[model samples]
Target: MLNSWGEDIDINTTINTLNGVSKSSSSTSINTSTSTNSASTAKNGDTRSSKSSTKSLANSAKLVTKPVSSTSSFFGKFTGGGGGSSNSSNNSHNSSTGTNQASGSGSGSLTTTTTNSSEDTREGNDNLTIQKINASIGSIKGEDIKWDFWKLLRFSNPDKELLKFIRARKWDPNRSSIALTRTTKWKAYDHNVNQIIMDGEYYVFKNEMTGVMQNLTLRKAVILGHDLNDRPVIVVRPKLHSTAQQTHEELEKYVLLVVEELQLFFKEKTTTATLLFDLTGFSLSNMDYTAVKFIITVFEAHYPECLATMIIHNAPWLFTPIWKVVKAWLDPVVAAKVNFSYSLKDLNKFIPTEQLPKYLGGELDYDLDRYTPPDGTYDIHLNDKEKRTILLDQWRVLIAEFIKITKEWILSENQSENKKLWLQKYDLSQKLRAKYIEMDPYLRTRSSYDIDGLLVLE
Candidate 1:
């Protein structure tokens, strides 16, 4: 099965006698003869294998590539196929073209002619009627929405003559909406979630300036223990006016529901703590769940213990959090060899306010959340090169420490002392370092996941 966004999902694992895939250990490292460990992934979950699957398409387009099953071929009573013409999109949407200038009404009703030559009748169990297809010019510009929607004016709908002008497309707005709403049908980057992966995802957030509506949306849902995007988990948009009807606590409860849906996806062989977040948009406005979300999730999963952190990166006020996280990553690392310390970002938050004044580079716009050094001054003065070295050192050290901790606590305590070979499989210190090294450039440079994690909801 494919997700709403065209992610192919496998759900049979849940229903069959079989269960999740068997998990193997990560590549281990030791001080003995040189040995290399490879990431032998299990089948129960997905790892991002299609690295280039989702190339960014045109700004005015999005791709939908789900393979429609026979049972679901006709969703909501209509379907469309064929490449569209965007240049002419404007011609069909001329708001002024309407016959009535003041009320935005046209003299003729819009209609659609079905291409199926054999089928003349509106056979489906729907309220479809034959109507004239009048081209609507661009009157309302919605993100990823290509077709000009018919405007329903209260004043015009009352007259009998105006009622004759109501003929519209034969397709349901909910289903037919994709023809105009889906922007790109590009090749998706296919990668199964790594059993031990550090991935970040985000959702697009939408809100009304009127403050009457606020909600999150995802094209598809990720099922647990399986690949999320292309699986059985229901992919749904948050209800309209959700913020008005939904409380923050209710949102969190649904978050837990997502976790439960994905419970089967994590097998015992996998031990990495991954993060998943929903990006609601760039503005939190009256909502105040930002800081609480971080404290309640993301950091706690990876800080104390867990594999690499994962995040579903979309939401309102997205820009601020990103600025803060990246800036935090830019703080200084203090060490014995360093006479001068450069800011690596994260540690800068905790530096005393008095000490903050001493640091050469400081970020004033960030929300330090009270860890800011008292008086906001610091004495450390490190160059860019020094800062880079400190960050590398901190990351590498953490890798080593993680392996050691896992060895002491995760290994079977009851195993015989002579049979220690199994412990080697779990010592992934060096391997972890290599993984970070590979991703560091992108993480610091592009922050590429931002696109997938965030949606521009107007």
Candidate 2:
């Protein structure tokens, strides 16, 4: 079956798309009027669906596979990752921890307050999940897991890596372990994400039939500035994207490349990002369902809790029906993060006027051509491969030692010993981060951020 973009899609996917409304509405009904009225003061509001609307919505929805299904074929022949069934297990931890509450002041500022809460059971669950993740680390290693990138994340901040999966699965250790393992396998064996980073701006392919060379990074998405919370803002111009420009595989690679690049900007304090979807001049032809599904899968399964907010700006009436079905496919938590901005003032609430793009009623004049790294800039890294390999080997050894200490920390009963082991792990993680910085030149291609000295290596 052909999707809205006229791309051949699986028959089962088409069927699922047709049935999305029935399936999604049963669980969470999207009040179109309520949503529109809350986000925009436009008088022309309509909440009506006809048979033709259903067909169009279904056609658009075909770009999105079943959200909870594990065997979606958008990302090559991978049988896992995206959404997978969780395996449940019993937990015995009963400890309580302090809770931090942030209250907003009258003048648009936040005040933090910390208090001990006996009702807080998250700490105990977190400890149990960490122990479970540590135990499964050995079995999940090999060619399937991108050892270099995984080690980079583990050594940089092991707790943060573990907590992402744990929190995504709601502190269910078994499910978290399963999701983490599957994602690693998908990234390494299925997607070859490490190779994508290595390829960088050189990721291109020529269509033999068309005799046209297609660059994967097509300037459709650009990292402009930071949000109010200092999260890196990825502004996506869907109007610039078309399925005819590249093959699905190329599009997938481009999307993953952008995601990996974005991850580099992440800090300990800023773990998430804000996606600003500028839908100006967007139409049916601009929709790429496969790309959309792949993005959803990556966020929900692979990179959980990585998106702080997604602002949809200047959405036209044509997109309303598509969004109705699309929002239903999203996880409730993810859906909740979606916000609508009808005007420049609405956007300024999340991003400052100084950082906002000029087109979006802000002062920042961001040109994609200027923001993109010039040709041959990333070529310098090719010579550093040998140095990168040596550093990687060293990191492997350090990670091995860290893992041993991690196991000891998980099992240690003495509070003092636990604290000491934790400090040791932290020190090792910092060393790992340093090692990554040393190997960074060889591993990743330089972006515009590096050229302009905007990216500070910590």
Candidate 3:
């Protein structure tokens, strides 16, 4: 099935396990591989709880790219075939007009129309802008920019993606061209960023901070319902943050993941979203300027025209100094959207209380663990490089364990007896198979009748 973004999503497996009890049926097939060592049954009469796992561009002349399916026909309206004019110029030459002979004979009268220079000039500028953007994309591809893996994967629609860089610089061809080229080089050179995504640095963070700070609950920087005009409302709880607990990089990754995830939640590709910063628990410890700077840079550089309005709720006196610095870094368009709310009444002007979270005097209560990408959105499948990284990580662990076991066996003088005992105790083959499944079940599948302890890779 196609996602809201028009990207194909293949949901190969759906296993439901509630309270450690596996449920297998036609509706919900159970394909769980647990470390039998951690299994324990809940009381029959006790209540059981289940928690599900959950996981833009542009400026004026708003950065817009319809879904691939729609864009094929949509862009045609802009560059379709048809606008030609026939030009006929009537020339009169006097050769022997001494006798002033009034001999005028015309076969047909030809008339030509003059086109609007201002209108044509605007069109020319737009075409030139698009060309420059394309050239920048060529450079990025030629130089092999680091996140260009999306292109290597052959995910369709290069023009649509290139539109993002074009709008980032406000449709300025020269500026956007330089911006795209520099961005590609910057990303390619940043080995640390490669480690951040490829190394799975996000997994190292505590689930609590990652879940909350990432706005998984729709309570913290949650994407609530839309405003009156239908722009999505994103509530951000700055109080929930502590730089000591979460590093700047981890926070940046969470922001990137959350923003991208929210993009999928939009029913249509929206150019704007309402932002609410709930700074009720404003503390000096939460003042991580580095993280703030990084977040702003990503929004301005990569996600233009995404912010429709921003409401800062309950800003303490101490935050004034910090806002002073942050305001300077923000774009004019973005800075203009900022609205500080002293109370819920002020915030209600932009977003109704009904759309706000309960803590902020809203009617909704969000559960983070039960969160899925809102509206059936799934995680973007890992590109080939990403898949390789994950596989390598799993293989590295397996090889380490194998080497450790081999070394122990070699250290023992009685190899035969030791081998028999080690095989019987560890059940290496079955353990490895189970480990693989635990690491990622999508890579392997098993039958309902398959026994856990007996299962082994060939």
Could you say which candidate leads in lDDT? 2
TM-score of 3: 0.45
- Per-residue lDDT tens digits of candidate 3, residues 1-458? 43211224331211011111222221211111111010112212111110000001111111121111111111111111111111112311110100111124233221212286863453344344434433443323221231232211121112223445555566453355446544543443432233233323133332335543444343345566667566777767777666665566556666765565344334323446787787887799877788788878767775555677888879999999888989999988789889898877887788777776666676766442343322211123333445634553453344334323422332233545444424422444334444443433222122111221112222
Question: What's the C-alpha lDDT at position 94 in model 1?
Answer: 15
Regions of model 2 farther than 4 Å from truth: 1-156, 205-218, 369-374
RMSD of each: 25.7, 19.3, 25.2
TM-score of 1: 0.21
What is the clash count for each candidate, in the order shown? 96, 1, 1
Q: List the global CA lDDT of all models.
A: 0.24, 0.55, 0.41
Q: Pick the candidate with the highest TM-score.
A: 2
Deviation (Å) of 91 in candidate 2: 22
Prediction 1 global C-alpha lDDT: 0.24
Please report the TM-score between candidate 2 and the true structure. 0.66
* Per-residue C-alpha lDDT of model 2 across residues 98-168, encoded as one tens digit per residue: 01112332221212232545312433343344344334433432212323335336223655665677678
TM-score of each: 0.21, 0.66, 0.45
- Kindly give the stretch of ten consecutive residues in candidate 2 with the minimal lDDT sum: 31-40
Q: What order do candidates take by lDDT, descending?
A: 2, 3, 1
